[model samples]
Target: MARIGVIGTGYVGLVTAVGMATLGHEVVGMDKDEGKIRKLKGGEPPFYEEGLEDYLKRAMEEGRLRFTLSTEEAVKGARYVFIAVNTPMDDDGSADLSQLLSASRSIARALDGFSILIVRSTAPVGSLDAMVEVMREEGKERGRDYELAYNPEFLREGTGIYDFLNPSRIVVGADTPEVAEEVMSLYEGINSPKLTTSIKNAQIIKYASNAFLAARVSFINEIAAVCEALGGDVWDVAEGIGLDPRIGRHYLRPGPGYSGPCLPKDLMALIRMSEEYGHFPHFLEAIHLRNEAQKRRVVWKVKEALGGVFTGKTVGVLGLTFKPNTDDVRNSISIPILRRMSKQGARVKAYDPMGGENAKAIFGDAVEVYNDPYEALDGVDAVLILTAWEEFAKLDWDRIRERVRRPYIVDSVGIFRRGAPEGWRAWTVGKGDLPSPEVSPESDV
Candidate 1:
């Protein structure tokens, strides 16, 4: 079994550490956050991911995984060191590589033997070259001391563990075939397609993948708008278009646009990188602008449902995270939507099955976060569904109908496209009219 070191211990790094350990490798995860390290040492995951705690505890019990704050301890005697640090977007839309570069420098300083430093962080195309330069500044020779490779992660937040173990494809980018093969060996137990190429291509692969997915989301959302205008259903439209073999049925669901950490950040970073390379990415820029407009459209829907004004209205939000099954609120479309509603004199009551605390911290006094979904809906003018949590679909809508001032729903995520509770007036994306007056007690479409 190969000895592996994972730096950063954030979403990406922690998953990699545990995944590799589960594959029978001795792994160490390093992070500067004392509280996070302490939690991991006690079999606690700092964030929510399905099956992460079970796997973490199992790996620790098997003596294959451990956590530490010392970079030296993480990389010492390790043959493969994965750099999975955060590359947050800057105010100018470029990826701030401060944390990534710092991790590289630390690895360079702590190198005890020849190790392959595989970058799993989402970065711009020439980031590996910058890492080489950083290590060179630390008096480390590239060939003799270490090698660099790019192995970008494509794990989603909620299903990171499952995605890691059952990846569709694995791409390793290195200077030589031997280096690529060495890195690919780490995942030999997993049966999947593996590709090896230049580091630049691997980096572009990651950014391009995210940008394309975001484009698909924005594309469908725009189509949803068009469908609404033409009195057509986006669900049928997306299905008809997605049936084409070239366009598989994925990422076509329309909502408040794509808002997770990776899609928005990577799309912006790719746009910045393209501009730096003397290319204007018009399509990419439009996709981003469209996503922003989609969020505003959701708020506008809420206002329209409440008689064109947010003043003296209560909006009970169903979900806050970007998506379901994760407790992450960073870059969630709900944040901007909630902030806009609260700013416009609307009382916002929000709840999430998992993201409540994180969303509460972010919204503060602006939003009244509730633990109970039914309580949040009490005396509300309209219910806004942002994240598509399954529980929201299974909510006791009959109970909700009796509590709310008005049984109005702005279903941004289309959770009620199939049908909402009887006697409820709802505005669903892509669907022109829903819950007809004949089927409901009140008639407001």
Candidate 2:
């Protein structure tokens, strides 16, 4: 087993560090945050990832995993140093490599000998092209040399551990086939397919993959609008197309547009990266524009469902986070919806299964945080399901119907039943299941 050093202690870094350790490699994780290192040293995971804590504790107990606040200590004697830092998006939506470059410089300065530096962070195309120059500069200053490779991660949150353990394919991009093979050997035990390509291809693949998924989401949302107009269901339409082997079935589920850290930022990065080479990404540009419009569409639906009354109404927001089983609220659609509704003089109450803390930070006093989903629904005029948490699907709809002042349900995720409650109004996106609102003469009488 190769000795591994991991930089950054965020979701990706922690998971990669512990996961490699679990594979029986001697791994050291380095982060400048002393508090986080202390927590990790105590066998506690720094963030919430299902089943990650158990593996972390097991790896530590097996003496295969270690944590330190010093990058020098972590990189010393490490054969493979994984740079898993963040490449956050800047104001203009370009991938900001400030954090990544800083980490690479530190790793390079602390290099003891001929160690392979792996760029595991999600970066723009040709991002690692400059890594050799930067690291060479640092290495010359420190009288040493280091090999570099680009290895982007595709692990999704919540299911990150499983994805890492059982990845579909491993891609390694390097300056030489020898370095690429060296990076590939780190996954020796895993029996998955491996692809070794130029560093540029590996870098572009991550952005291309995320942009395609974002496009699919935006495409479906746009179709859902037409579906709503023509009395059609988007789910059925998408499913029909997804059944084709060429299309396959994945990321076709519709919801409050794509968000949560990756897709939105990656699309922008891809656009900028492509433009740098004098190539315009028209399709990606359309995807980004479509997603923004889709967010506005959600607000329009709420207003339409409310029958044009916005003032003095109680709106219950279910699912505050970007998605379920995650607390990350980066660019969550719920924030914008709540902001819009609040501007319309509507009092909004919100709840999420796991995103409350993050939502609280974003929403502040703009929204009332509820521990129970029913509490958010209590006495509200209308209920909107923004995220498709499994619990939201099985909500005591009868109880919710009784609690809400007006039994109106606007389901963006199509999690609620269409006609479950009498005298209740409900609408869902992209579903042919919901018939038009039926009005009875007795209702007016």
- What residue pairs clash in candidate 2, if any at all? 233-432, 234-430
Residue 352, model 1: Cα distance from true site in angstroms = 0.5
Best by TM-score: 1
Clashes of each: 0, 2
What's the TM-score of every candidate structure?
0.96, 0.94
Could you tell me how far off, in angstroms, the CA of residue 196 lies in candidate 2 after the best superposition? Answer: 0.5
lDDT scores of the candidates, listed in order = 0.91, 0.83
Clashing pairs in 1: none
User: For residue 337, what is the lDDT in candidate 1?
Assistant: 95
Error of 2 at 180 (Å): 0.3
